[model samples]
Target: MSLLTHSRQRTAPSNTPPSRGGGRRTGRRAGAARKQFTAWLFLVPTLLVFGLFAWWPIVRSLLLGFQRTNLVDPAVWVGLDNFRALLDDPLLGTAVGNTLLFVGLGILIGFPAPLVLAAVVTTVRRGAGIYRFLVYLPVVIPPVVAILLWKWFYDPGSGLFNNALGLIGLGPFSWLESPDTAMLSLVLEATWAGMGGAVLIYLAAMAGIPAELYEAAEVDGAGIRRRIRHVMLPQLRSVIGLLLLVQLIGTIQVFTEPYVFTGGGPENATLTVLLLIFRYAFQDGEYGQAAALSFLMVLALALLSAVYLRATRSWSRS
Candidate 1:
């Protein structure tokens, strides 16, 4: 009996309670519960709004995309008829082609303009703030005002563009009248209006880059071109990728500029995907087709975003 008692005393822990491990586990569970409650509390408003506005509407649109309705009668399920009709429509092809062209041209001209402007501004020692403000001014202008201003500027007889060309002995070209020039004119306007945002973003990104990198390059006997190529370009890769993706997504769905300026006229030269969707839904009362087109556009944007995200994964890892 004595030996057994001594063995028991030796095996028992002194510093901890018999239920200490279980108590610690229980405390951890309580803490986790509190954290979960706080998370839910923080998420309540966003979840409520998303469920009410975003998810509900998305589900309803999906259902409507497969049905036929005329604003009064019950929606009749028509299966894939709307999609089939859309596939067969000639204007669908035209809209797609025009949208791709518009996005391509917009990217060609608009994407690089901001980077160049930012670089130029960074190189300026005097009046940099004034130049930045002037460049950013158009971004704050109302879309209608900007479009009207461009319209006035593109006027064949009394426009600044025509006057400049005339000084070089060129004839006053009809900007919005000809199909060949109408889309180009719209693209030019979009480039001018949208460039400000890009410039600001690039400028911020460039400012984040350490000045020591340039100084180090100079110490190595590097000239301006070499410094920019080795120091600036590599540092700006992620920013350039992000801006390119954003520009591509936004330009693909361009509506206001073309709608207010050309009205998709001169043989539908300026008709974009969003404009086509607007015409179908509001003008032709084809909500189902318009919904389908909207869905396709969303899918395209998702794919582009995914590609860019993958390309910039290195930035996140770094």
Candidate 2:
């Protein structure tokens, strides 16, 4: 009887149910929910700030784009009349063209500069930090200071640029005087001032690249040029594309430099789209036209952003 009882006890399973595992899982889910709620609570203030300050203003401006208003009277519905006038305005066309030119020239001059500087820094064996600091120095300077310095440098008769050109027997060129050179001078100044940020970004990107890749390339008898072409360039393609898009958008809205330096003078050679919008709204008191122009600028930027997003999506898929 004792042997039979022992055998029966051995055959029976443990009393604890399998559902305990499910209970543990439920507990974990509850804990996760609590953490998530806490995180959201922390994010609420940031979201509220963005909504109130950034999003609300954007919404108001978009609504204002459709209405006509001034300091004295309340806004009235204008429908598409403002848009029609904007399209018909000869000055608008000129502003658009000049804005496009500024963006293009700025990118052409500015984009590669930082990349080159970053590449050089990466290759240097010594004093790289000093070089970076020197390059970044101008970026931290106030815009007013930078613009004033460039203005002094570009002075036709007594500027440093003219002096340097004279050493090589070149003419005392009127940089800001002529319409052709005015925009170019702006491009040069912008490039000089803006290259530091690009350099920093590119340097960071380069630092993220694995050293093993370069070491392997070196072991395979690859030279610097070959490695740059096959490895570095391919890795930087996405970064370069992103930077190009950002630069295009920023350059299109350029105002401060041109406003301070050129005042949209010399036959409006340096007048950007934003400057024209400002002149309309404040100087001329043409709020309708200004709103219309602002809306058009927004449309252009949206289109550019859309195209860039599509290209980025396609690249990611590939």
Summed backbone clashes in each candidate are: 0, 0
Q: Name the lDDT value of residue 281 in candidate 1.
A: 84
1-318 per-residue lDDT for model 1 (tens digits): 699999999998798648778999999999999999999999999999989998998877777678777556887888998889889989888888888998888888888888888989999899999999999999999989999999999999999999999999996999998988888899899989879988988899989999999999999999988987999888998788778888888888899987899888879888888999899888998888887778778888999899879878887455
lDDT of 2 by residue, 103-162 (tens): 889887888888888998998789989999998988999987999999999999899999
Clashing pairs in 1: none
Alpha carbon lDDT of residue 264, candidate 1? Answer: 87
Best by TM-score: 1
Return the TM-score for each candidate structure. Answer: 0.89, 0.86
The number of residue pairs in model 1 that clash at the backbone is 0
Q: Cα lDDT of model 1 overall?
A: 0.87
Task: Note the Cα lDDT for every prediction shown.
Answer: 0.87, 0.87
What RMSD, rounded to one decimal, does every model reach? Answer: 3.6, 5.9
